[model samples]
Target chain A: MTGSLVVVGLGPGNPDQMTPEAAAAVGSAEDFFGYFPYLDRLSLRPNQRRHASDNREELARAREALAMAAEGGKVCVVSGGDPGVFAMAAAVCEAIEDGPEQWRGIDISVVPGITAMLAVAARVGAPLGHDFCAISLSTNLKPWEIIEKRLIAAAEAGFVMAFYNPISKARPHQLSEALDLLRRHLPPDVPVVFGRAAGRPDEVIRTVALKDASADMADMATCIIVGSCETRTIERDGKSPLVYSPRSYRGGSI
Target chain B: MTGSLVVVGLGPGNPDQMTPEAAAAVGSAEDFFGYFPYLDRLSLRPNQRRHASDNREELARAREALAMAAEGGKVCVVSGGDPGVFAMAAAVCEAIEDGPEQWRGIDISVVPGITAMLAVAARVGAPLGHDFCAISLSTNLKPWEIIEKRLIAAAEAGFVMAFYNPISKARPHQLSEALDLLRRHLPPDVPVVFGRAAGRPDEVIRTVALKDASADMADMATCIIVGSCETRTIERDGKSPLVYSPRSYRGGSI
Candidate 1:
């Protein structure tokens, strides 16, 4: 008997943001594997078994899930945001590449969901309306120098940036370092948004200019978006300002 | 009476991919405004009305939608993918910024949905697992020279790139020009994916090396992803290759 493995995203901590395809995958799977918090988001039937692991145990979790699938069990892997973006999909693919041959033969498919950056971008206006890039602030899987280089390049190219995993107790200094580097390249008035737990009940979305933005405004749950020069804030008489990046750029044909 | 305007995404031609929040917004709104094809995706109630227009009239559509909202009518503006990303949200924000003062007082919220690039990435593998940038190849709102500069900067930054509106009959040569510019900066063997009508019944996804990626491979319906140097393709025995950019970088601590 041949079994299958499906990977799906929960979409930025809100059930309403999850896609129907992901919900269907969750409903059909007999076993679920994921980081503990992601797996907690599911209300599985009694027949479904849960295999929750730590945040850094992606590869091991992938291997175990693949083995279960190879054993003719319907398995699913869950991720917090869009599975393809710095999540379980890449880990599962890497495991299939290096694991036993049978693992490659198992049926595998991925369902997309709303990523954190997109959720955060929506809460604020459309700071990502034009060209944009997403970078992870954590250096656990990449070097600080590479991150710095990318920041400079993104600024020079006039691309708005979204930063995931912006801060944690372990990597307290990186976010500040990144912001300092960006301050040198981008204008002081550039809008920087700190969106924590976007789409959740206790969500916090704050916008500050580059000169006033500090590392303390963010946490591990926050997704930060730094707007390009073209980004603007519209102030209403009685409401908070709406921030957005205009579609048309300078020297455009329009 | 205070009216609200909500802009939402239909998510790459699939009803299953549309978020519950977006669906709720659509259901609550009395009137819908969008381009003709995007409006065609919706099935509204008998009381609801759709105001469809041509593609290029974004500002005019935004103004009309905002006017209705300002006059105490529930309004919704729909876009194909995530509205914040090269879609209707920016146009709506632009209209609000330039229109009458009361337009700012209307309640406005944006609901996120599955973007085309994320859907295409899930179908193959996680090509956007690492740092990535998205650029629109259409010159209707931006200059060709700006696109070229951003392309060069994205390549030098070691970023996987996603191209939106890559080609059209009017802009036939832009994609080729963009690829030729990347050929100078990126490796020839880097993977280039053309994902046409992703999540739709007639979807076609093709992967080729940068050297083989031609303009004809893409159309306005396609979302093209260019892998970074770190991206790899794993070949299965009888199945198609899975493409992914590993989460860890070359100089990563892991």
Candidate 2:
């Protein structure tokens, strides 16, 4: 039996986003390894061996999946969103690469999921329609200077930004500092979208000016969205939503 | 029987991303209405009526889906990614609101789909691990200054960004100009990730300094991601790939 590894994205929340291809992989899997909540998102069949854990247990989870794949059993390793983004797809790749050569025959592929940024963008209007970028605030691999330099470059380029992992318990001022950097080059009226737990029951999406978002938010679950120099917010139907459209237009049909 | 609208996201490409709930939604859909490519993503039973149209035929697609719901059928308005993000979810809502109250009785709920941003993020790293924003570049509905202002703000605040609809045949310089503005605030070394045809074959995920990206890219099928100060690229086994962790300490674990 030729075992395969399918890494799936569970999406921001809810299951409607799952595609037919994603479902087929899950249904065919003999072993399912994923984050706790992600595994819970599925109702398993009888033959499936599920490996569920938190961040601390990722090592254990990856090992089990690798072993299963090595044994020639189809395995599904899942992530919350697209596995390629911030999830475990990379880890799986690494694990396979480091594992025994017998595992080389396993087919490893990634199934995409919806990231929180797309959900936030929709809730707040077309805030991400133009030139924009996304960054993570985690200081783990990169020096602060590198991130700072990128921020400056993005700001100068006038791209909208989607921020993931903005604030944990320890990194409080990083976001504030980021806001400060943006203020130097961007205009004061720019809109910032604060999306908290998007697609969940407690989801919150608010579009505020650049200056106000820093004061209004400070949480780990939050996904901060800073618009470009041209982004704006309007009270459409009494809903204050941020919108982004290109400036130079020839008025062609879309 | 009470009818409902369960909008689904098809992920970027292939199947592994489908959650159980999302799969069930599609499986149970009595009628599916969406673009042709979106419909091609699913395997529907023969009983389901698929109203697939050209990409530009948004109104016809919405009208057909509305008719199905009006007939008291469990209908789904499908899209490639998150239906809410520049897809058919909003249009379905609008159709229900504008058409008749009879459609209102049909339970109107949104099943959030997996968005492309997360897919791009996973591929490139955690460019969006912090506060960030998204801005659309389309000029169909609103003005361009709005996008500009939002871009400026995102840049000034040093938020990561996701740029959708970045460039098309008619609007090439919009992304370039936006990049120029971002350069004013963001450091020259800030990382930028450009994703084209994300999740689909021919997908491109690459990170470079913001300055280099402006001149290098200008395509419609691309999703641009800009990193904050915290994002970094690391070489694993002599292969350098972008990696963004939430914090420096957390990064140590990876």
Candidate 3:
């Protein structure tokens, strides 16, 4: 039996957001590997074996999956959002590059899913309607200086921004520092969206002005979106107000 | 009779990539509105009415959909890829903000889909594994100057960049200019992916160095990904080499 491995994204917290391709990939796998919460979200067949690891064990988990696939075991590595975005796909690729040469022959593919920022954008109207940037505030992999520089550049270029891994118990100060960097370039009234556990039953989405935004609004599970200068909010009678950036730009010289 | 409008994405050309929520939204709609090509891709139910318009009629189509929904019709406005990204959700919101007050009362929601960039990233490995920015190369709505400025900022900040609508028959020079600007800050061998009609039957994905990248490599259907300095290409025995950015950054004062 020739083994294969596929990295599939579960897509936020909603099964409805998962693609048919992703579902099919998951259904066919004999072994599943992922972070504990994500692994717990799946219902496995009686014969299937699941390996749930901590979040910090991405590289090790990826190596294990590759080894399983090499030994002719069908393996599926899962991620909460699109596997290619700060998830298992890259980790798998890194494993392939550094592992035994024979591992390269295994069939590997990435199945995309609806990412957190886009799901949050849809729920709060289309704040990402125009040009945008997605940056992760986690300092575990990249340095804090690089994150700060990217924030300043994104704001200066007038791109709507989505911040992933915005806040965590260990890295509490990063989101606030990032927000302060944005405040230097963006207006005080710029709209900011704090979306916690988007697409889940316990999801909470709050829209606040840049001046009123606080770091306490987010946690590791939250995704935050800061709108460009063109983003606007439309008040409604009994529903949440709509937030969207207009498709056209008029401020920059034509 | 209550009216409702749901903007749904078909998700990068592949039917398998379409989410269950998007499929459900389209299934229940009495009327469907979208650009001609996207509308052509769908087979409507016998009772459903399909309104296919030219690509340039987004706002007008949005208004018509809103009007129909306000008149107690279940309307679905469709776009390829996620509706919230450079698509119909923002147009519908803009229509609501500018249209009569009654339009705002119509139930409106956006269903997200696997966007083009993510689909392309999955196919070519995770070059978007780190911080990234997405910009549209089309100069019809925004000035070329702003696009130029954003490109410079993105390059300076060491972002892997995704350029949507990279080239078209009407505007061919913009992509080359964008590439030339990147050539200044990015290394000569930085990987550039030209993914045309990604996830479709005739999908084509080509990875080249920045030094060899050209304007004619893409058209409107193409999504171009320019790798950050950290992106690496791993050679395989008999398969396409994988391109991905390491999760950790080693440059810029780590």
Higher lDDT: candidate 2 or 3? Answer: 3
What C-alpha lDDT, on a 0 to 100 scale, does residue A197 get in candidate 1?
89
List pairs with backbone clashes in candidate 1. Answer: none
The lDDT, on a scale of 0 to 1, for candidate 3 is 0.91
lDDT to native, each model: 0.91, 0.66, 0.91
The local lDDT score (0 to 100) that residue A105 gets in candidate 1 is: 89
Steric clash pairs (candidate 3) = none
Error of 3 at A63 (Å): 0.9
**Residue B218 error for model 2, in Å?**
13
Off by over 4 Å in 1: A251-254, B251-254
| Candidate 1 share of real interface contacts | 0.89
**Per-model TM against the reference:** 0.98, 0.61, 0.97
Tens digits of per-residue lDDT, candidate 3, A1-254, equal: 55999999999988899999999999999999999999888889899999999997999999999999999999999999899888889999988999998888899889999899999999988999999999989999888988988888888898999999887677889999998888888999999999987878999999999999989999898999999888999988888999999888869411
Candidate 2 lDDT by residue in tens digits, A136-191 = 76554455665676677676666566777676556677788888887886778788
Write candidate 1's Cα lDDT for A1-254 as tens digits.
Answer: 76999999999998999989899999999999999999999999999999999998899999999999999999999999899998999999999989998888899899998999999999977999999999988888888889999999999888999999898677899999999999999889999999998999999999999999999999898999999888999988887788899998964211
lDDT of candidate 3 at residue B54, scale 0 to 100: 91
